[model samples]
Target: MDTATHFAMGFGLAGLAYLDPVVASTPALAGAVMIGTVIGSQAPDLDGLVRLRGTAAYVRNHRGVSHSVPALFLWTGAIFVLIQAIMPQAHWFHLLSWIFLAVCLHVFVDLFNSYGTKGLYPFRDKWVALNAIFIFDPFIFAAHLVGFLLWASGVDPGRSFLLIYIIIAGYYYWRVQVQKRMTELVRQRIGKTGTYTIIPTLSWTNWTFVAKTEHHWYVGELISGEVIILDTFTIKPENERIAAAKKSFKVQSFLAFTHHVHVETKERPFGYEVKWIDLRYRSRFQGKSHYMFVAVVYLDFDLTIRDSFVGWIHRGEDQLAKKLDSNRQLS
Candidate 1:
């Protein structure tokens, strides 16, 4: 799940726990304590890399240690030890004192996807069945989707009201995978340049994409089935219709925090290839450890967000192959 969404989920769930005492009369600090219970929601399937590595190999495995209940316990114990060492003044009940509920919340969010997490791994070897959606999908972010909508509508949120927000966000992880596949297929056949990378169009269309091939990139309008090929290397000043990228203050801050901020303006055969670090951990769909907001840079074109990355249409990998076979001159 995206960090912003996670934060929202955490904040909302914590707020809801807080509301428990006030609304349901649970108890004081129950909500705040629930916040810690939610920790490790993303923990269960820490062994995801096993299956991800593929079958038929001793070195390859899924649901290994992280999927084990014992692992979770060990991790929690380690957490407690750290808490004791660092915050001896705090009581054990003080979550910041000796427990890790945030870890549970993390694992909960992880379980909502297709590749379910090992929620009770150490306790039970069964994977929690969450057939609701994929591991990550932008569609589920509909609440995050509706969030901006509600914001625009001037809807203000109160404490504990965050539960609705967390439920929606926890569900958003499933939707991200849906868009991820769509974007991947788009790149699989865009061109033979092999220089392309699927860029996320989160701001424009959640499922939208921009293909950055070696010398070119194409913005696709998946719905209209339109593909426009833009010359990435040949740009003249007269080509004033170039697009502009919207500055995301949050993403920018993340990059800046890691000292990965970069902006380049150089001439290209087409227009410009805005190369910089992809500190934005949007590549997790492609497979990576944690969503590392590390200091790194990657190339993005000016037309990405502007023209909506609508350059060329992919004929599909099979279609591209068939077209190539037909075009090969009979030697």
Candidate 2:
């Protein structure tokens, strides 16, 4: 989820806290709980500070260990102590419990989106992306807004958010089933030799998918349950250039964050340009399609990395080239 949606979810969780009888009656505790919920909701994303170091660091760390099982309890305990010191009148157990729930819900909802968290880290390093929901879901955000409006209009906050959450729960189930159906459609068309990654778009009936078979890769679109292959690439054995490009930290970080990775190498005037793309996301600009997440590495004739970048490319190769040129540093 995006930052705004996460903050909205925090307020939604605070509203749900009204279900507690003790919290409902005490204004001081209710205020304390709201603060705790908001903080706990945004805590795991503290890894976002890595962006200050660089995109490579951000890619390698954001939502990695911070969203793990151990970080959940750490966030809860830390927030509880902070809020407790501020509001000594607040119930210790209730404050701790609500903060815990807030952090848990934050990680749980993140699993539904395309950019998933490493929630099972230490136990497993795999990224758990359900690909069911977009990062910023309007329906979920609107529900929280409606709950706030209803509460301001004299409606019971507890009952209002409870019903909202129930509906949201149902919405999640429907989205998950829709993703499953899209995956099935891709499998039925592709014959299911290898793995398929289906990514949902804003439209309910539209999706993007990548199918990796033993010999080739299939990139396509799913429209109204129909599978349309837009492009196909043969899976080639890794050569020396590809191995050399992976030595760059930018390339390594990009590869670490993506599952359906596709590498392309091109000869350049000075050296070679190796581009690593995550096939999971596809975008269209002016009717032409483009891969979204990418890492570009410039290697010399001797395979030494000279310059590199790991991030999204929006405007196209022209703009990207300009960016790389402006930042290029020779080793």
Candidate 3:
């Protein structure tokens, strides 16, 4: 998620949680609580890039160390010790207490959906995930929006929005096993027979698999049993990578993603750029190129914009080689 979205969610949580009785009487308390909560929401993301080792990769897929319960306690104690002790004027326990609640609420809210949480800190082996929903679902977002609006209007309803999300997230969580089984069946068939390659399309609602062979791309809705075949995309993983070769795709697989992706280049002496036409469309599901694809790889000597991966070619501007100015007349 982008920083803006995260901040907005944080603000909403803080503003709305004020409506709850525990936080209503004290604005200062709510402020500290909200601060703790929002930070907790993002705390798990710290270990996102850290791969302890290749050994824990499976459970660590989307479910990693940050999502682990150990992580929660680890962070809690750290936060408590740091903030509670550093600020001596305020009662360490008073502030620490609210912050702890805020952090816990943040994690629970994230627990629902397929991106499960490691709720049981030291004992639980599996994660608590509501697989029915996608990690970034618009529907879930809509619900949050409503909650935020209601909270803004000085209405907390004494109901914990975080708790509500858990219940709803749980409903979807239960359905994930069915989809998991379906994915396992496909994984087995393709894994052994050497017939197809599966691509995981992490959608907001559910996990969709795109199995590709040499000739066709088999799109299957894991839970819906809806399958479609397309000739553009390769069924095999090898070709699939080639088929989905845009630079944007590469930028997306980050420990975390930020929406404000901007590219800038400085003016240089003897600015030079070389570009060409190799036609390519957005969706190459079919295994054939219709002379409409082009890869314009340009070499720029300027350090200001050395190796910018221009994911798209609109008209005349090469994504990287083009001057950074938006109003400099499209040439």
Give each model's clash number.
61, 0, 21
> Which model is ahead, 2 or 3, in terms of TM-score?
2
State every prediction's TM-score relative to the real structure. 0.35, 0.96, 0.47
The parts of candidate 2 lying over 4 Å away from their true place are 326-331
Range of the 10 consecutive residues with the lowest summed lDDT in candidate 2 = 322-331
Tell me the tens digit of each residue's lDDT in model 2 across 252-308.
888888878888999887788888888877777777778878999888899988888
Name the regions of candidate 1 deviating beyond 4 angstroms: 1-8, 11-64, 87-89, 96-100, 120-129, 137-158, 162-331
Rank the models by TM-score, top first: 2, 3, 1
| Top TM-score model | 2
lDDT values for all models = 0.40, 0.88, 0.45
lDDT per residue (tens digit) for residues 101-178 in model 1 = 555555556555433444675566555534334334465455544554553565543332464555666545544555
Clashes of 2: 0
- Cα lDDT tens digits for candidate 3, 1-331: 3333345455555655655565667666666656665775566566655445321233244445565666667776676666545443254455555555545655665565434566664577555643344455554566667777666686663365665466546745654555566556665644533333222234533344444444543444433444433323433232222223223222233212211111212233433222222211213324432222223222234212222232333433333235333234222
